[model samples]
Target: MSAQLTAPQTPAAAPAAEPAGRRPRRGTFGLASKALVNGLLAISAVYTLAPLAWLLIASSKNRKDLFSTSPYSVGEFHLLRNLSDLFGYDDGIYLRWLGNTVLYTVGGAFLTTVISVACGYAFDKYVFKGKEKLFGLVLVGILVPSTVLSLPLYLLASRTGLVNTYWAVLIPSLVNPFGVYLARVFSAGYVPGEVLEAARMDGCGEVRTFARVSLPMLAPGFVTIFLFSFTAAWNNFYSSLMMLNDQNLYPVNLGLYAWSQNTHQQPELYSLVIVGSLVAVVPLIVAFLCLQRFWRSGLTSGAVK
Candidate 1:
């Protein structure tokens, strides 16, 4: 009678499974690791910014205040006066040096970008004689630092009587092997072979296909190469110094170096040099700010293909 009256017991419910792709809740260890990473990142940011901060402060101060004051502290803001001296000194020759730098950087960067895009596209799309070998040579060039080539470049420039001329700096910069490599990587990712085939089927010339179809796709590559060449040409002190002796043809980097060298005899030039250095940084800052979108977008350009 007792057994017959007994009822069946129910089973306990199972725990629910987490949804697919959802990350598990971070534990204390995970949180600690995240905090550690963030702290490191903050330290890096401060490390990178310290020089620029010093530059700003140094630029604002007179020479008397620069050495005596704390690096982060503000001083006698002779910024306006320093700028006037910077521009007005030596019949405004600093402006000429600035112009020289702009010309070299812009002209060289543009040419380098175009040539790099062309070469990279060729390496990626067209199968030809010694293609891989040629590309390998380019990779080799990347491994070889620019300083290694500076002497050879100077010798070649001398042979052609291009020394002390704008062409000396501009020519070598235009042949950026790194740019070519980047272009190839970009072409592989950005410019689809199908698009090129379609363009060809529609009777588009190779040059036309590249110009109308591939060039637009390679926008990120172009900006990256342009910035590289610009920086190379702008800070090209050793090559410029090796090739150029005439002050008239000197880039701002060399010009500033010359001023810095003379500072022992002329202590007042320190303010001018500091001000010039600050001003020199502005164009690069502006360029990066303007093209930063392209640079960021290009990061994923070669990531896929």
Candidate 2:
């Protein structure tokens, strides 16, 4: 056999090694993105907490320290004294305001949650004429700022003789368009259609089905809505400002605002405002801390099923 005398083939040129400087580094972009996000979050946290920090520090100081020291400085800790004066001021009116705030927030939030969740359930489950149209209207209401509706609400309250009464605030608070929208979303996500069908097959009426099966399943959503409504009603300053002239009906926010306005005339009120504001924040913090588990579950439940 003829020897294979083929010319020795040249080795295939190795792929030119990419320059080390030009090689893509794994995770460089990812690390850069993470750093950027962390930086932005830190900035946002600082911005949000700075005023709160000032308030906290200032609340501990007397008026002299407030003016004499830096805003962030710690002065003579008089927190208990401040609380005593705050609750004792003006015939213990702060207590009354605190009570009113609780009533408005708790009662109104409960009612609002029920109504909103019911409406949302109806929107999701029931097929009625003009259903989408009505929901669209609700969405329109959401687009309309609450401030814009205050005038109309005030006029309606005046005509009905509700102005300056608890009803004026409570009634309007019960009609949260956004809450209704949220309820509908939650209903759609949390409730399965088959469950309703099974309930109906078991001879359960619509209301009975809702109350027993549907509502129980929607607990996370319920707590979420309650928290939102509570926060909104708790901080309901503008509505109270517009609707109420009676100081007796004031919520904590409105009362604190009033104290802030009077601080220029009564220098002692500065301490009151600081301490009152501090007190007002406690409820919201407590609410979140207590109910955060439910809120978290509500947010994540519908995502999967």
Say which candidate scores most in TM-score: 1
Error of 1 at 104 (Å): 1.0
Per-residue C-alpha lDDT of model 1 across residues 149-255, encoded as one tens digit per residue: 98888888889999989899888888888889999999998887877787888898999988877887888888988998888888888888888999999999999
Cα TM-score of candidate 1: 0.88
* Candidate 1 clash pair list: none
Clashing pairs in 2: none
Local distance difference test, each candidate: 0.88, 0.90
lDDT of 2 by residue, 74-149 (tens): 9899999999999999999999999999999999999999999999999999999999999999999889888999
